[model samples]
Target: MQDWWNAFMPYPDVDVGHASTGPLSGLRLAVKDLFDVAGYPTSAGNAAVLAASGIKTATAPLVQALLDAGAFFAGKTNTDELAYSLIGGNVHFGMPRNPRDPDLIPGGSSSGSAVAVAAGLADLGLGTDTSGSIRLPAAINGLIGWRPTHGSLDNRALRPLAPSFDVPGFMTSSLEPMAAVMSAVGMPATNDRPISILIPEDIFETIDGVIADEMIASLRSSAMPIRKINSIASFSLADLAVAFTTILQKEAWESNKTLFEQSPDAIAPDIAARLRAGSRLDDEAMREADRIAALFSREVNRLLCENMVVALPTLAMNPPRRYAGPDSFAAFRSACIKLLCLSGLSGCPQLAFPIVSRAGNVSLSLVGARSADRMLVNVARRLSTCLKEQMPF
Candidate 1:
């Protein structure tokens, strides 16, 4: 049977045997094409680029760690062209179907990875979260998506996309596999403990009213005291978005300028346009972005000091329709960036949990201080338990 999900790479499946015994033994794993797999070409979802780039000589250390810990490698999965867009529709490889809602888009560039896990095709899907790539898809597809603190996971042998913001992340059907995968990858072990929840009034307001209310209600159900803060220090969502976009564009241009110049016509028009814009950014603009980003990071770290977690909607609204027009997608993308850019700019750890609202399936996100990746997962697990007991909330 042909898989309508269209999650895996078009090539034949690559099977790396699972360990006889370990934490993840018997677990199925699928990787985004951006991660090198020894001899396979790291396509990054662009056919021409794949044709131009030769096979990788080494496997990414993160993928290797999972295999060593007993996870079976399934195969490479599709991704947005060059891992650039968040919409998930690759002009070349086609978008992965949203297991929860086929009509809605499967948020990307990590689109296939999330779908693979959501559809039960893979127990764990390894992806890269540059700015909500993992979190957005996880939320849209009703799964748990986690983006660790910048540089927390090894990145060697992975394609670069806004290096400063790009971090290894994953999507899983449930928290147990996510926790297990994190443990295998050398994530510091953390004890399960209750943490304080902070609701950033400004960020939550960015989400649609119905979705925001649903998320807030979930937080209320938790015994953790929820504090309403006026702002994340002085930084607004818009400010963070601008700073993050500027830096990302500048860095992306630097990383892929050569590819753009070599085969401009081979890339998708939307992605090509973004690269062109990035090429036009000046050093002064990047410097200003850096200054703003540093300030935002410092403020976020201060606010999230140990034991504090901030909750907000993962995306401003639900995922855009699969065939949404360019103009409609542009507006949706802009609003989403405003919320997602917070973590990218601040370099904090974030986890998105699937939550339903009147509008439809939405995701609630929790942001924590640097090095709090494990803590965020633990908190999500505990909260899941609480929500289950108080079912039909």
Candidate 2:
């Protein structure tokens, strides 16, 4: 029989051919393809990118940290090509089936990382969420995925799409390992007062009905009640979507322009088209996007200050089906990318807890102020406990 994981499958045999062990001995890890892992090819879910870039010699610091913790390297997982899209399908590597419902998407660019953890294939998996890539998949796959504030986790030896937004993140089936991974990576846990959660209805609009209902029920049952932020003005998610897309495409184009120029034929057609679009962006548009990003960041900080954490649906819609046609794929793919940016724009820490399953899927996300990652992880730990007790997960 053919292997179910296909090209998306990671190398499971990892002993590193060495005799070193430490605290996290026997634990398994799946590193996203975007992160350099000594011998594995950084495919970034595209054959062309891998062929052009070749194997990376160094391991990311986060990966090294895990190894120091005594975790065995499982292998590299799939990602959205160039870490650009959120939908999991790679035109090159076949998309991994979501463990919840293979008919639906697994969510991306951290697609394989989420699937690996959700399916119990790995104890922990590294995933990069440029735009909800980490949290969205965790929500869809019933895993705990955390993104630390920018720079809280190092990004060295990793590929970049938007340097400002991209950060190394990880996913696990439970909060315990998630916390352990974060702590081992050097994020200090700080105890806080009572937990305060902010619920912004406008953004919550993008959440599916089943998840919204479950979250509301969860809030009502919790010892701490959630507060609605009334003073915050709503920016058009659509407009923000446009701005976010334009800025990222432009930035990605600039960052990878050299590669594109050297071998335009090497880049995938869809990605090449996106780079062409980014090329059209003038300095003025880029500057305007910067202005908007700054403004939005300030407002987001204020909303998060009122509460220790802000809660939102990790993905706007249920995991979409794997589209067969290019047009259908592009449309579904774009929406997922835009929604992923909500947390990405903040550059803050996010902890995605698997609170409840709806329609055989999961939904849970915790957004925190920048540099308050440890506290956010604690909040997720408590929430996960309450969920397990109430929902019997």
Candidate 3:
């Protein structure tokens, strides 16, 4: 039933959904393999990790909250092994099919969750975002992905991947379901729209020229007007990417080295080598990375202060074509990291909401101040309401 996209993990016997009437009463929830479910196994999409992770004895706090709010459990979805890669092709469990085109990589490590939601198999897909996992897949699949502020929610029992960047996140088809999930999870109510748009000076130049015009035109749409716009100082994508990679690699190496070391063949050879390289970084490099990260966090927060949100293209180009050569995937992934690293480095809340045009479907993300998750969603809800329908999400 939920397997058409290979999105839901192959587990039919572990049934655990609380039936009650609440805010999310009619929604079916898809949990990513990174989170624990009481009766289900958290495979984390790797054969070796699966062998080590026995059946979870308790449900994670966030998952329990959604279930308590009356969301029907669909099933645990697949993820990139140890949440490492963004391409979403699991060498172990097979890549989840992208329902949108079927030929594009469903941006991951939240691959299955995004595929399931996009395929109409579930209404809400609970995933994690560490450096664009949620946003990338949601954008590629034409869905709304929300990455909340780091540590803003109860994140117990989650397998860590770069603890400083990991945040529990979700993807949904539209604005309403996203709002419902937010309210269901006990987030505070938002009455007023928190919107004062900020555009980076060189964003258009940074992304590929192919869709740059479409993104530019979206700014003039009634949904996101340029009437009240201001310019935020630009940032170097290359510098940010390098700094982000340094921190992410060090943390990932510390968190997941043992798993790969214990079962080297269980993990992909390339990823294993990456982890090893991260472990080998000298202390001086690590210190410089931390310094840059801290400085950027302050700079971004200051710029996005007082309800101002930065709106930009969710991706640099588009999802890599499925089954493409390693070179193609690498170039696309690198370009995307430049676009996405700021959100992770700064710990801001980012919402990847759909923007439809004759150029086809693309997403524009609103990056807001930390802990302003509800505010960002409410702002987008207003925009979606005003935008022309039938534009094809």
Candidate 4:
């Protein structure tokens, strides 16, 4: 089907069957291009990869589980090249239309998946989150997005970007469907009612002044008690971003190097530059970046252990316009990465729930500790008067 939004990858009648009875009964599921599904090509959003692939022999175990749980396959959605950038436009397959605003970019890697759900083409969107793929788009498009704690869900049969950071995640238009998916996957529920909300002073400081003021004001209006504290050991956002990019470059290059090696011309110019950046990093730099990342993970996880959820703007700014200039996009990405790297490095469960204001469509993300995925979902459900009204769920 040629969707108006270009959310799905073109395929020849890619069919999926599901159980008659299960928690996910009759739910429409949109699969990201990265996952292997029987009877369809697994392109991973790169034309070279698409050209090299054939119909997969076996469905990914994760997709199988969802199918068994009774979710019907909607279609495979578009993604960024090899699932790399945060903003959506793919060089080969055109960018997925953002249901929120046509001109605004749907957040990337998981862009098409998010668009699928937001545009009412699917009940749930299956995507992966290494950095902000799921959460970022969910925020921009006003959908509920969950990046499960790393390793809490199956990652097998999905294309690897950074193995240590890659995790299977999903997007949905609302809460009940998300809860059903969680139940189908057997994610245990948590009683961790958030006792406090941690507002990292440094994160807000990095945002543009108007957006910062609006976010803080919005949070203050919430019923949950908020605590402002200095964090990251005096490390600037650039430091944390550097830590994430350095490690991702190394791991991503290693995971997909063979593809690049075989089809040297397949890599997009931007993606190639990122891969080269990683390729040139010396072994020692990778190790040092890893060390810093581990420390940050521990620090963030420690806060979560106390039943405190970290709350911040999901993306540092509103989504950039489509086909933005490279220099401008690069600068924009650098700022956004700092906010995204928090959950990426920690491997914690971060959920983005939309909260639209007169200013624009913005979102507040609540991050829980590892394995606290269900808790954040529950927290979203318990949103106070103001937040509840803004929630699509």
Candidate 5:
């Protein structure tokens, strides 16, 4: 599987057995390289980081929980260097191919996890989402990607991107496996009643016209009552994006400063440049970013309370072409950050699911109130079933 997809880091295959009986008994899972696997060094997608990291003495509790529940481990998948980029093209390890369309970029830094699941190499794949890493890949590759509310899941053994925004997430082809995995980790059960849906007019308008129309049509066909809101709060999407980028860069720089300073050349040039830029951010800018983020979080929470959900496009546009030059790719990423920043800023749970459109596959996303992880999954399940029956597009 690794040979075909380039989805895994270069390491000997390691498989751990599951118990004879449990909910996930026969499932095969692939973990991102960032998680601590007992006796294996966590590479975090960089050769130097791998070399500097000593073997882990214990496994991440999340990984242990899955193993204890009867799921078998399928080795580590590749990640963006330091999990910094959403493009998923790692300079150190080669890009993981998008199984659905080989020429397109697989969304990342969770790139490999999405590929593993989409290609049927693994039943489930673990990845971290910090600023849309999980959801973006899930959207581009036509899979279910989930980001639990901030602090809902423990992050002790996972690699840090921006600790404030990073959360452990997974990618699967369908909702059932995702629900089973969440149950094993003790996530709360979802409410099964009908939910109130809110469409953020500004955010939806950011998407390409063709994709937006397809997404709207799908929502309408669900026969669920939907309301359009001019804004989630006083903040615009651009404002949220700026605030997220400012704080994320500041924290990311702090998290990886030592590595960047010690072995600058060991990191990929594009990622290294971004880190260097982060290091230059001043205290005043970060303080303002924090202030804006706090206000945004409060407003978003208010809007999503009481079984309410927000729907929007996962990516403003489709995935960029493979090897799109750094300049073009950078622009595309900036545009996407405008939409992705909403989830990060508000500390809410978001689920990205695929919608078949004339342009191929595009993604539709649902954002739920903070700590409403299970509800978002429930919504995705219902929406997925409806789409299949209606085939609205």
Candidate 6:
């Protein structure tokens, strides 16, 4: 019963000396290890990286924003090695146990961030979602995780994985706190337009039956009208994965080449393998990946039009069982990333809120327009309010 991810730093005293105190003052907040918090070493779940890269001397912009917003920080949480894997397991820091069911694996690379929130250890937790890092864990843990549009938040001090898609996100048990954190972190929080929830026929079909039903029922009860829309004409998920990998690899290779070349033996095995994989992607393939990304972005925008938020299951499958076999891992990872990329491609905002439980598992997901993050927040808030009212004893 020992908490492997327990906070080394106790909750901060917000009222004594901090901005925006008394409101979010005592609220507990946890940051992913990738973010630089002034005096802390950004371990990024790797001992080698911590030793190799010098200690961060200043707080990251996002960290500063959270602190300024009156959040009582609970210290850094665990992450996947170099924030690369969707699964949270690390050879170094043991896997963070899922709060809902200890028998299952907590989704990652934003592993501990979501668990911290789900376990009620923190009011809000910060995580980075490049693929399904934030949303997948949020889905599994039954929490609300919001990944804003690309470039919506500053990435000045965050360690990069896939720079193009590595947007910082937040996890909380409810949409109110998630929206509050986003607003505090500088995302617009309110909108005046009537909300439109778009259900993508192709992507929704991929979700497990029970989870999808819960999500759909929640949407139906909302004050807004739900529309059936198809964005991004049918495309191979495998192709998207190849493109995402090529781009991440090319960027990672360029970013870590010096350190990797200098002390190739010092890096973690998983991270090393990932970097090596990136190195293997051909230049032509990388270019093709970029082309596909651009093509998809345009198509997605056209499909969304305006004032319409796309909705889909946060994860295509259920939480992975702890120590799942290699084949299970592959299948779980594939489903998780495939659904997430729909939003990642267009750089749209996504707000994953857990609606209900089925067979002892939580059902969850997000809906939002590209760059229209404020509208999405408003929509989520309204949806959560409606669901609470409709709940029967």
Please tell me which predicted candidate would have the highest lDDT against the true structure.
5
Q: TM-score of every model? A: 0.96, 0.90, 0.94, 0.95, 0.97, 0.90
Residue-level error in angstroms, candidate 4, position 35: 0.5
For residues 173-204, write the lDDT of model 1, one tens digit per residue. 88889889888888887656667889888887
- Which lDDT tens digits does candidate 5 get at residues 1-393? 535988877786555556777888888888999999886789999999888888888899888888889888887899988999999888778999999899989879988888989999888889999988999888888898988888888787998989879999989998899889888878888767778888888887887776777788778888787888898989877878988999898889999999988999998888888898899999899998999999999998888887899999888876788878887789889999998888888899898888666777678889999778888888877787887888744
Per-residue lDDT value at 123 in model 4: 92
lDDT to native, each model: 0.85, 0.73, 0.84, 0.84, 0.86, 0.75
Clashing pairs in 3: none
Q: How many clashes show up per model?
A: 0, 2, 0, 0, 0, 0
Ranking by TM-score: 5, 1, 4, 3, 2, 6
The top-ranked prediction according to TM-score is: 5
Error of 3 at 148 (Å): 0.4
Per-residue lDDT of candidate 2, residues 23-67 (tens digit)? 566777878888777766677666666777665677777788888
Candidate 6 Cα misplacement greater than 4 A, ranges: 1-17, 20-23, 210-214, 221-223, 357-361, 388-393
- In model 3, which range of ten residues has the least summed lDDT? 225-234
Compared with the true structure, what per-residue lDDT tens digits does model 3 show for residues 1-393? Answer: 838788988875677968578888989999999899998888888887777788889999999999899999988999988888889888889899999999899889999999999999999999999888999999999999999887887889899889989999999998889988877776676557435677675666777676676566556564553533333434477887898899898998998888866887888876787798789998998888888888888888888776787878898887778999888878888898887888898988899988776668878888888877888887777656655552446
- How many Å off is the CA of 369 in candidate 6? 2.5
By lDDT rank, best first, the candidates go: 5, 1, 4, 3, 6, 2
Model 4, C-alpha of 283: deviation from truth (Å) = 1.5
Worst 10 residues of 2 by lDDT: 10-19
lDDT of 3: 0.84
* Candidate 4 ranges beyond 4 A from true positions: 192-194, 232-234, 384-393
Q: List runs of model 1 lying over 4 Å from the truth.
A: 192-194, 356-360
Q: In model 2, what lDDT does residue 175 have?
A: 71
